[model samples]
Target: MLNAVEFQAKIQNGLIQIPDEYKQEFGEGDDIKVIVLVQKKSFPKKDIIDELTENPVQVNSVLSREEIYSR
Candidate 1:
């Protein structure tokens, strides 16, 4: 019988960092979904209202950055 692998999600700077342990569990092009609890921070009445009305930020599990060469 085949077994299913498990994975956990991590949030940093509004980015989702997928653990390397799941590399073998999922395929390179597979899609994954996870539920995250958004913390409601205490803010001033106006700030709180504005924040609540806006959409939350989400990032992919994997990401990268590049630097260009300068002459």
Candidate 2:
């Protein structure tokens, strides 16, 4: 059987301390697993021009007199 308990705590000295209430569910010699999720501080902003420039074909280069007439 498996049981799951979720809670948030601050890590100190690279260690996370489990609360006392849930600790009693496990015996002294029992093995346990832990997972940690770190919150990202911020996301980088992208400019519209920067995104368009990444394309292989530039609109300016393809904008010729013949190309415009053919359209």
Candidate 3:
């Protein structure tokens, strides 16, 4: 049987430190699977729209409002 444990940890020096509470479940030479998940920083939609409106991008080919809506 396989057991699953979930805990939150921070990575330091390219290594993940397991909590002491769950350490007893494993011993030396034990093989385990690891999966890493990273959270992305998100900016507010209004802020992003405001920034874009303040400084628009320069494009060679400009699309009309109808052309944009047709897609």
Candidate 4:
């Protein structure tokens, strides 16, 4: 049978240190699967809007007001 344990840890010197509470479940030669999940960083909405307004994207395709309304 296989068991699963979940915990959050910080990576230090390219090594992940497991919590002390879950340490007793394994031994020196135990084989375990490691899964790492990193949180996605979020940007401020106002900053993103400001950046887009400051440097807007340029498109070569031109659509007239009548063509747009026709759709």
| Candidate achieving the largest TM-score | 4
lDDT (tens digit, per residue) of candidate 1 on 1-71 = 35455445557799876677766676788766656666666854667667766965575663444323331
Residue-level lDDT of model 4, residues 1-71, one tens digit each, is 68899999888999999899999997899999988998757854677778889999898999999999999
Q: After superposing candidate 1, which stretches have Cα over 4 Å from the reference? A: 1-10, 39-71
Q: What does the lDDT read for residue 17 in candidate 2? A: 81
TM-score of model 1 (CA atoms): 0.32
Model 1 is weakest, by summed lDDT over 10 consecutive residues, at: 62-71
* Superior by lDDT: candidate 1 or candidate 2: 2
Alpha-carbon runs more than 4 Å astray in model 4: 42-71
After best superposition, candidate 3 residue 50: deviation in angstroms?
9.4
What's model 4's TM-score? 0.58
Stretches of candidate 2 exceeding 4 Å from the true structure: 44-71
TM-score rank, highest first?
4, 3, 2, 1
Instruction: Identify the runs in model 3 with alpha carbons over 4 angstroms from their true place.
Output: 42-71
Local accuracy of candidate 3 as per-residue lDDT tens digits, 1-71: 67788888988999899999999997889888788887657854677778899999889998999999999
Task: Estimate, for each residue in 16-44, the C-alpha lDDT of model 2 and write its tens digit.
Answer: 88888877887887777778888767877
TM-scores of all candidate predictions against the true structure? 0.32, 0.52, 0.57, 0.58
